[model samples]
Target: MPLSLYLLAVAVFAMGTSEFMLAGLLPAIAPDLDVTVGAAGTLTSAFAIGLVVGAPLTAVLARALPGRWSLLGSLLLFTAAHAAGAVAPDLPVLLATRVVAALAYAGFLAVALTTAAALVPADRKGRALAVLLSGTTAATVAGVPAGAALGSALGWRAVFWAVAALCLPAALGILTGVPARRTPQDAAERPAVRAEFAQLRNPRLMAVMLLAALVNAATFAGFTYLAPVVTGTAGLEESWVPVVLVLFGAGSFTGVTAAGRLSDRHPGPVLATGGALLLLGWPALALLAHRPAALLALVFVQGALSFAVGSTLVTRVLYEAAAAPTLAGACATAALNLGAATGPLAAATTLDTPAGDLGPFWLSTLLALSALLLAAPLHPALRGTGRTDAPG
Candidate 1:
């Protein structure tokens, strides 16, 4: 609702763009660098690994920096990394640059969410977080497509250059728009990070984090290899790949919007229903993958259900954190990156089997169910607590 929230959204849009553009550019980058496609694809994996390592490390190390400062600094780091990637002469150099970019991405998200929480009334926390996350949805709609087009037209490095340009403006915008405030570690602040960690000893928060990771693993397992699935398994033409992906993006946008509204009213129910839907969606969609109409319908529904997980996941993690939401938010981000890295890697290994398409679906189904099952322990803790708060 606030103009500042929209600016934060734009900053996140830039970060998401840089993070996701690699998928489209991998072919171009591989050929240009004289490397195998699989090797070039490791750039994306490198970024995820960096994110997994950086999220908590940065949050802990930068605890003394103002939220506004932390966000701006992280964006600046993102810009620099993009610039480095654009100019790198070798594959190893480019891969290193990606790690830098991902660390910034992971760290910036932690700071951004903390800033969102501090920016509004407690009742609007869900909405504020939604506004921040809309950037990722927007990337699915706008950023990834634009990056793909740019890479196709000008070359993959050009895409990195474009991302760098976007990052500069975003970094500056954040520095200008966000108000200066005391650091989280200031004397005025409540419970330290250690205290937050202690409170996080709760089974509920831990279960939610695991669930979030597993849910993400399930989705990414299918999505990372989607081109193969659609063309080989679903029998769709290669040209249809982009079309289906665009539809998935549209579905993600739809889900994010609806989830934000529902979360404001009933966070637990929305998440519970979404998790169940997502668990059901994998098998249903896999079975229908060969039917054009059914596949299309399932694809859209799966996109919606898969993305809605974040709305509830963020809220639950923060609620469980009580007064020290930063650590919980950071930990959740780390868990998310862990899944992002693991899903594709694990799926790649499994999909090489004789069953091919069936492998990913079965693996994803198991992961999704495991993720949903984590909700059992968390259910009782959430009982009777409102969406914004939980007992410590």
Candidate 2:
């Protein structure tokens, strides 16, 4: 892989940090902006709305500029949006900033996917995408926690300022390291815009995306409300929540990087085994969640399976939709955002039930099982790791 691919990871690290760290800062933001914590939570919704609304549009509009230039422009917009957010006078202004930043984030990620994959050889495409996504997993392990610490020490606004400042270097890296000329994926290699959208009608790609979304939904279902699970169900101290998160993050990072190396060589088994373990592991989690040790172990295991399998499914989507390079990235982005949004919403329904805190595990298990069943029939298509797209 090229040094420029790692530069893309740097940009992804900044954006991923901004995307998730806001959760930790919400309480401070709510009080500071004179809104309830629940009201401030709408900022996340605003971010989701931007991703859902902007993803396809970004894919459509990205062809207007060369790949590196598109990345540079989006990073600049993201930086500017966060800087505005840091000084917002009210929640509405902050909310608007979140939407704009998320839109830019979507654009950056869509371009990064194709750009990263294009920089590498056909055989290394899956790993290239994985390298870019490592920035997000790294954010899970370190960046968000650091942002939370920054929020605690300097205030939440300072966290935003820090994120904006970080993006400047990433943007500079893009400007300096990434190529201005378009790659095969973006320039001469692309199909017509109408042809790109036409891939949506392909059932193989659709099914793969469905599986990807379910896997992500299962991940979030178990993950989003984990503080409660760790403290409430596992009976661990609140202080242990961060430690559990680190375990999960470490496991996920290991899983994804491993997936990068293995996915192109063994896509089918990678997806199937991960999905099956998720199906089994979630039940074990629900049953033994009362045991602190069992809960901690399962948290790491589940996180590993979720990301390793989920990453494979994402690569499969690109393979199935290989003919539509631009739309492939956009579709992967949409599927992930869909799962992330729905997972917590689905698990939220079970919080007051007899399952209580353990419901997320049960729900995640079902979602994972559903995803695997969907993938079972599609295995043959996914198994083809080599390039399947025709010449330009």
Q: Which residue runs does candidate 2 get wrong by more than 4 Å?
A: 22-45, 87-94, 183-189, 235-237, 385-392
lDDT of 2: 0.80
Clashing pairs in 2: none
Where is model 1 more than 4 Å wrong at Cα?
A: 30-41, 89-91, 183-187, 231-239, 291-293, 382-388
Question: Tens digits of per-residue lDDT for model 1 on 1-392?
Answer: 77778889999999887766665566578789998655665776688789889988888767777777888888888889888889899899998999998888888887777778667776666677778888887886678767766776788889888988988777767777887777545546656778877887876677777777788778767666665666767888655555666666677778878876666447667778888888888888778777877777887788788778766576666666656666756876776777777776776666557857656666788888887677776775433264346422
User: What lDDT score is found at residue 205 in candidate 1?
Assistant: 71
- Candidate 2, residues 241-264: lDDT per residue as tens digits? 657777777778888998988787
Candidate-wise lDDT, in order:
0.74, 0.80
Alpha-carbon deviation at 127 in model 2, angstroms: 1.1
